[model samples]
Target: MKAFVIERYGKQEPLHLAEVPEPKLGEQDVLVRIHAASINPLDLKIRSGALKRILPLRLPLVLGNDLAGVVTQVGTKVQRFKPGDEVYARTDTRRIGTFAEFIAVAESNVALKPPSLSMAEAASIPLVGLTAWQALVEKGNLRKGQKVFIHAGSGGVGTLAIQLAKHLGASVATTTSSANVALVKSLGADIVIDYKKDDFAKTLRDYDLVLHSLGSEELEKSVGILKPGGQLITISGPADPEFAKNNGMPKLVQMIVGLLSRKIRKKAGKQGVGYSFLFMRGSGEQLSTLGELIHSGAIRPTVDRVFPFEETNEALAYVEGGRTRGKAVIQVVALANQA
Candidate 1:
């Protein structure tokens, strides 16, 4: 089988199309013939070795995170699916390789694709959907009539998070470029701040929660807008000690992470807000719930663009430049002469 792989981790390195051995199916796995795959900033970080100490992925790693595909085979213990089941998943980060013709994902991390979507559209949802679900519903426990600020309203996670926040009955606020103000509003954002024209933290206040996806400067300012006892969940780093401990990192690493987050934690403390870092994980059960929401039209996949499978590198470059309105997808298997 052919897969796009990186021989080494560097921002300057390009993905090479290489012929590799097929992935072996484990007892708890399902083999998928990928129809479409989505590129994520996580893939860029991994490719650049930004997460080397934490991830320690194998050399010659195939690159991709989200996949929508058809089940070609299932392992002995896999009970929920069989051959020909259409599915989508954000593959476990430990064994990510969706930029290929096939991937053997643990059955527990796969879910049936929403029937209302095309393969490329299905591929755009999993990672961003799971991230939104975990942050807004699971961690934030956002309630009706509450106000939640989601930074970067036009990015992959931002697009889904904005819509999901509104569906959960919370008033959503988000920041984006001037050109994207209308786009985020259509995604159900009640308050749209053009980050280029206005400082969101300076204008928005008394929020129940803030979903921070940017870096230290914005993370610092986000706390001021949250009311006392409100939560601030960040998908971007300076990983907190709790996350490090929960994920079983080395004691030294945990301590270093604690040090990394000390400033933000102390600031949130002074403002009487709760702060934690989120590294979204894969869960088939959660994906199922998201699929139902997508099917019902409560939330929709926002695909900014789709590239041919062989143009995976070009797709990555486009996303890396941060030009997308929603999410960018690589259509691995064309449908009905799709461009």
Candidate 2:
């Protein structure tokens, strides 16, 4: 199968097209003929060796995470999906390599694609969609009539997060550059702060939740905006000790995490607020629910660009710039006159 792989993590020059052996499917996995794949910030971090200590990878690793495709074969133990079923997923990080003609993912990680969207659009939803869903619904416990703020409103996750918050009956506020203010507003953000010119911490107050995705400075400012007892769920740095415990790290690592987390936890305690880190996980059931939302016209996929399969390097370059309006997809298979 033809795929793009990275022999060493560094610049984009290491990315090259090659014919690699097809992956062997596990007993609980399904082989998918990939139609489209999307690039996420995680992909760029992996390509740059920024996550080397955390997510160790073998050399010549294939690069991609989100995929939308058709099932070609199903594992013996897989009952939810079958041959010819259209599916989409944020595949297991350990088995990631969606930059190929085919990939084998566990049945538990994939769900039926939304019927209302094309393969290209569906490819954009899995990773970011799941992140937004888990952050707002599962961890944050956002309730209707609440007020929530999402950072980077024009980015992949923020675009979806805004809509999800609105769908759940929350009044959403978000931060973006001036150019994207209208876009985020259209996506249902009731308030849009121009991050380049305004301070979000000063602009918003008494928020029930803050979905953070920025630097430490922004994270520090986020606390001031939340009302007492409100929550801040961050996806960037500031790893919580609970996250370290959940991942089963060594005691020393846990202690280090505790030390790192103590400052934020203490600060939150002083304000009667809560703080935690969120690293998204795959859940087919949640994805199926999200698919229903998409299928029902309650939510829509937002794509900023589509690159050909062979231009994976260029796509990576574009995302690294960190100014995309939404998701960026790679069209792996040529559609019949769809272009």
Candidate 3:
């Protein structure tokens, strides 16, 4: 099986294409023949060693998170899906390797792909969609008539977050460049602040929740936009103590994470708002809900570009460039070319 793997962690290091043995299927796993995979900022951070302390991957790691494909076989204990089932997933954190010809995903982390979408389109949904679902539905508890600000509305997570927030009945405000204002609006953003021209914190006020995904400067500003008791959930983050504790990090690591977020938490406290970091987890149940939304026309994927499987490295680089409108996908198996 051909896969792209990172031999070491470095900012400019390139992924090498290698023929590796197929992943072993566990009792509760499903073996999938990957049709398409998506690139994410998390992939870049992992490759650059930015998340070493938190996620510590084994060397020569196959690099990808989101995948859409067909089930080639199911493990003995897997019953929800069988051979030939079309599925998509945000591979479990510990076994991520979707930039390959095949992967074995835990059945609990896999969901049937939305029937209305192509493999590439379904490939783009899982990670970002799960992030949005966890942030808005699970954590924020967004409600109708409430105002929510989602930063970076044109980015992968932002594009989906805006739609999910709106669908949940919250009035959505988001930040992006002037060129993408229309795009966010089309995705149901009620207010779009051109980050290049205007500051989001200054533009949005008294919001019920804030879904932040940017630098510390923007994160601090996000706290100020919310009303008292507002929830600020950040995906791109200085991980908070709660997150560290929830993930059961070592005591020293927990202390370090706490220190990293102390100032921001204090600032949010002073403003009478709550701040917490959200590192999204893979969930087949949540993906199923998102798939229904996609099938119902309530949410749509915004794919900025599609790269061939051979250009997986270039796809990762493009995502690192931070200029994409939505998600970027790698077509691993051209279904049209298949006999």
Question: TM-score of every model?
Answer: 0.98, 0.96, 0.98
In model 1, what lDDT does residue 52 have? 85
lDDT string, candidate 1, 291-332, tens digits: 888878889999999999899999999998987888899988
lDDT (tens digit, per residue) of candidate 2 on 1-339:
999988888855458899999989888999999999999998988888876655678988999998999999988898899999999988887788999999999999999998788999999999999999999999999999999999999999999999999999999999999999899999999999998898888889999999999888888888888999899999886788898888777888778778877877788888889999887887789999999888777789999999998888888889889989999999999786333
Question: lDDT tens string, model 3, 100-215?
Answer: 99999999999999989999999999999999999999998899899998889999999999999888888988888988989999999988888888877677789999988988
By lDDT, the candidates rank as 1, 3, 2
User: Relative to the true structure, how large is the alpha-carbon lDDT of every model?
Assistant: 0.92, 0.90, 0.92
Query: Per-residue lDDT for 229 in model 3?
Result: 96
Compared with the true structure, model 3 gives a TM-score of 0.98
When sorted by TM-score, best at the front, the candidate numbers are 3, 1, 2
* Better candidate number, 1 or 2, judged by lDDT: 1
Predicted structure 1, TM vs. truth: 0.98
Instruction: In candidate 3, list every pair of residues with a backbone clash.
Output: none
